[model samples]
Target: MRSNFRVALIAGSIVLSQVFAVTASAAPSAHPERSSLVEDIRFKVEKFQLDNGLTVILHEDHSAPIYSYHQWFRVGPRHEDPRRTGLAHFFEHLMFKGTDKYPGKKWERIIQANGGSNNAFTSRDYTGYYEDMPSGTLELIIDIESDRMRNLNMKQDEIDSEREVVKEERRFRVENSIIGAMYEALFSTVFKVHNYRWPVIGSMTHLNATKREEFKAFYDQFYAPNNSVVVVVGAFDSGDAKKWIKKYYGDYKKSEIPAETSKKEPVQRGQRSVTLRRAVQSPTVMVGFQAPKAGHDDAYAFDLLSNILSNGNSSRLYNRLVYREQRATSISSWAYTAQEAGIFNITSELKPGQDVDRSLMSIYGEVYKLRNGLVSEAELEKAKNQVMTDTVNQLRTVSGKARALAAAEIIYGDYSAVFTDLDKYNKVTREQIQNVAKSYLKPEQRSVIRMLPKE
Candidate 1:
């Protein structure tokens, strides 16, 4: 349900490709634009645990004949043993390698017969599996998922095969892309002790070093039914889905999950900087400011600040850096919206021969002005409207709703948060937004990265 969140500067190139032209809606907005705090936007959510402790949530949406099956596990790089940096993401690939009961071919046959597609991803906080299929094929989807969850076919040979595959994935994604290389270097230098510094795709060296026994150990520790959430969305009888889930998943036993007792990162005392050299035509600059978690009150204000500075062509950074100043081919900012503590970042790709230092200073000037003065009421209104419009539009498709439900439930711990969380954005004021900028966007709390063309 969550968006693919990379570092702000790097994510800009990809996010920009998704033409997010937020045109104002013409018809009267049926629902109240303002969030109604007391009224929970409850779907027909029924929760149950199988005999083995797998948590299942069923929400019946009969808008169409298709269904989305989403499964989320409470493990990610954050939960990995310090030495096991990419284990979570590595396991994400292994999960699809076919189980004993559902070998790769058999699993594909069922999915192909049912007109469904499936994929999985791993993040810092969680890993997720999802399938979109015809509503009538619920049983096939359930069977495949249950089999893999309990009985994975982890062989030494298969692990070796997937490790090479994952290595090439890292090469393609991190080694090839200019910005991706920059992020790998940036995070490596940025977080001295936090697990957050490790790339989610994992290191090729670590992936190769991971033993098959390690995979089994990881599965036993975190892949229990109790530590996972099953999300079913689309046209279906809720009662029927629940019965099928219990029958298929009930026998799995939940073990006592191990606690994650990693070293907590101490507050950073000073600014840090790093440089990356890539064989690219243009240079790029990135600035990351440590910010609050997604649940914090100030987070909403920071989200608004991100939009005001770089959400669109009309945003301040876009206008200043790319349009007026003509220093950058593009400029953007993002509040790394995460459930855990995250980064507020700005990125700019320099126009040929542009002064990087001057461009960086200009960007700083924009932040200084915001911290010193209130954003205009009109600007605040536009940002709020943009957030509302985007939220409503995301639910326009069944697959999108399913993704939203899975993400909200797994990350925020509440599916109802899809609607309730909007309140934070609605209630943000100009002064509060300015105050947050001043509080969190200080030089001492930030990191700077510059990627230059290889000399």
Candidate 2:
């Protein structure tokens, strides 16, 4: 289970009109009768920095006697050397290989024995490991997490074992899966030089080439107090939790992460497309349009545009393609904003005999409508409501709260931006949505990947 992960294409970000973060639980649910989701969401977080530079954020939720511990690092595929490629994700595998104190699966066993669950995920922008356990075990979590952060003992045998595990993960996810392969290809075709061109799971060749020393050096540089954020949400004495955090995480010296340097992906000049054949039952297609980074004035509009096109069966693309024409088995879209450039993506699994070019035409037909015509007031309002509802759901749980907060801090560097999200979406005029579609969704700016059954 640890070998598997889901790519955070959205980078735990754009939670823009998406409204994600350390939020939710205000004294009164914003008067449902009232307008303004902006005022509707809120959170109280206490933040402190350790002497060693570990930033801690605590949100006390006494509603349940449980807490979610999320440790986020400013390290992921984005920080990886193009040659070393998967090193960021490689550590995701290594981190769990265990420290001398909790060697092997004992670390997982200890947590499970204590009635808690733990897992981790890698993304284009960052890596996050989390544990959800009863608040009673807070100190236990801190002690063990801190221990592994500094004392992980990685031997060549362990590294080799984990490498093989990730290699299989890539095979299963990218090499074998149709939708998976299309998504991976979409990034590569869309960017010429950006690190985003690579899969978060990474390529098998680089995984094989990366050695133990490279892994050790990466761990030493990225897994430091100065490079990570610790967020705890749920029932716990904020004061006691702070003390435990200092005792467990303090003392470790910060590492000197070299100044990050990566060439900006050169501007994409024209439409790009790739056709890949796979042993699949149905043809699949994905289209990606280069868009702005998260926190861009335009990111929110792109997100709303995505929702308007794919939020449900009634969405424009779904209504036109699936419900009406039956060209696709299913359809979806995303405006994935990240620390770097973002992509506005549309994906569809087509009927067995659907013509790929015809499918592309049908999909573009729906998109061009938004570019040429403004969405109805009612339709635009519905998209805003859906975006708000999703954001509210993101705020409903402590884990959701941590992700939103951590994303805001790490991706945008301002936790408070979370509070303004609903208003951001609310203020997006219909014209802004249409204008963004016209500006970013041009054919020259698009990259398409289509997968067909092995013939």
> Using TM-score as the measure, which candidate wins?
2
Write candidate 2's Cα lDDT for 127-228 as tens digits. Answer: 888899987889988988898888889899999999999999999988877878888888888877787888888888899998888888889999999989
Candidate 2 Cα errors over 4 Å, as ranges? 1-36
Tell me the TM-score of each prediction against the true structure. 0.92, 0.93
Distance from true position, residue 346, model 1, in Å? 1.0
lDDT to native, each model: 0.73, 0.79
- Model 1: per-residue Cα lDDT over 1-455, one tens digit each: 11235311111111111123465772112233545632433355666667776777777788789989988888888788777678888888788878888887788788888788888877677888889898788887888888888788987888888888888988988898777776676665556676777888777777778788888999988888888988888888887888889888888888678876645555667988888887777889988777776567887787778878887788888888888988999887776545566667788899877787899899889988898999888788877666656566655656666666666666667766665656666778998998998888877777889988888
In every candidate, how many clashes are there?
A: 7, 5
Kindly report which residue stretches of model 1 are placed more than 4 angstroms away from their true locations once superposed: 1-3, 6-21, 26-42
